[model samples]
Target: MQALTDLPSLQQVAASLTEYWSPRVVAEFDDSYVKVAKVHGSLAWHSHEHEDEVFFVLKGHLRIELAQGAVELPEGALYVVPKGVEHNPVAEQECHIMLIDKKSTLHTGNVTTEKTRSLNEQLRPL
Candidate 1:
C-alpha cells in the first residue's frame, strides 16, 4: 500500500502566492482545511454560522475587527473567531496567514463579495 505524503512548507507555499485575499488550500486535518493566504488591505466583514475560523499569523501583522472590538496578532500569534460572530481581517502591509476551518466553510462566510474565492479556485496547485 502507498503511504500519504507530508504537506509542503507553509513558508514556501505562501511565498508562491502573488495575490492578496485569495487563499490556497495546502493541507487538510480532520474535517477542516489548512489554508494559506498572502494578505494586505482588508477583507469584507462576514460571519460563519456554524464553524469557527482560526487564523494564524505566519509573517507580519494582522488585525481582526469585530463589531465590539479588534484583536491584533503578530507573527506566530493565533486567534479563533467563534461561529456567528462578525469579523473582518486587515493587514496594513503584506502578511502571511494560515487559516484552519471546516472544509465547507466559505471564504467570505455569509456575505459574498468580490473577494470571495471558491473551493475550486483554492484547490489550484501551488
Candidate 2:
C-alpha cells in the first residue's frame, strides 16, 4: 500500500514470500493492483487481451518469453508486455518480482495451470 508515511517494505515482503508462482497483493492504486511473488520456474503461456502487464524484477533474474523472442531482466530491471501479446515468465533460479496489473487482471490470463492463483487468494491475509 502506498502512503504519505509508514510505507510498506517490499524487501520485507519479498523475503517472507515462500510460494513459487503465487502472487500476493501488496498494494493498489486506482484501478491497478501491485503484487509480489517468488518465482522459480515458469508460468503458463498466456495473454491479457485488455490490459498490459508490467513486471519488475526485484531479485535474481527473470526471462519473459514472447513468441518473437525472450527478454532477459537482471535484478532491478522492468519490462512491460503490451496487451494482446502472449508471454510466459520464467526464472532459471529463484527470483522475486513485483507485478503491476489491472484490478480485474487474471494471473493466468486465459489459461489456468497449477500455479494459477485467483484474486481472492492473493488478497487473503498475509
Candidate 3:
C-alpha cells in the first residue's frame, strides 16, 4: 500500500484528492487495505462473494443502496456491507470516504464498470 501519511491526517489526504470515485491506498493492515476516496454519483451495483467491505464517512454524506434497504451515513459515521450482499454507493455531491477492504476484494465486486478500479491502480503511491 502507498500513502503520504507517515503521520497521516485522513482529512488532509481527503482534501488533497482531485479525482471522483477514485480511491487511493493509504495503508495496509494484515490482510486488509486502508483506502480513501472522493466520490460523487453512483457506483455500479455489485457484490463481493466473501469479503466484507467497511466504509467510514470522512466528509459529506453517503448512502449504501442495498436490495432490501439503503443505509445512510453522514460524516463521522461508518457502515459495513457484509459479504455476498449486493450494494451501490451514491453521493449527490462530493464526498470523502475511507474504506477498509480485504486484499482480495475488487472495487466493483463481480461487476465491471467504467468506475471500477484495479488493485494495482489503487496501490499506486498516494
Most accurate candidate by lDDT: 1
CA lDDT of each candidate?
0.94, 0.92, 0.93
- lDDT pick, better of 1 and 2: 1
Q: Write the per-residue lDDT of candidate 3 for residues 38-123, one digit (tens) a residue.
A: 99999989999999999999999999999999999999999999999999999998999999999999999999999998998898
TM-score of 1: 0.93
Cα RMSD, each candidate = 2.4, 2.2, 2.8
| Alpha-carbon lDDT of model 2 | 0.92
Once fitted onto the true fold, the runs of candidate 2 whose alpha carbons sit more than 4 angstroms away are: 1-8
Q: Rate residue 83 of model 1 by lDDT.
A: 98
Q: lDDT by residue for model 1 over 1-126, one digit each (tens)?
A: 444555557977887899999999998989999999999999999999999999999999999999999999999999999999999999999999999989989999999999999999999988
- Each candidate structure's TM-score, on Cα atoms with residue i matched to residue i, is 0.93, 0.93, 0.93
lDDT of 3: 0.93
**Count of clashing residue pairs in every prediction:** 0, 0, 0
- Which regions in candidate 3 have their CA more than 4 angstroms from the true location? 1-6
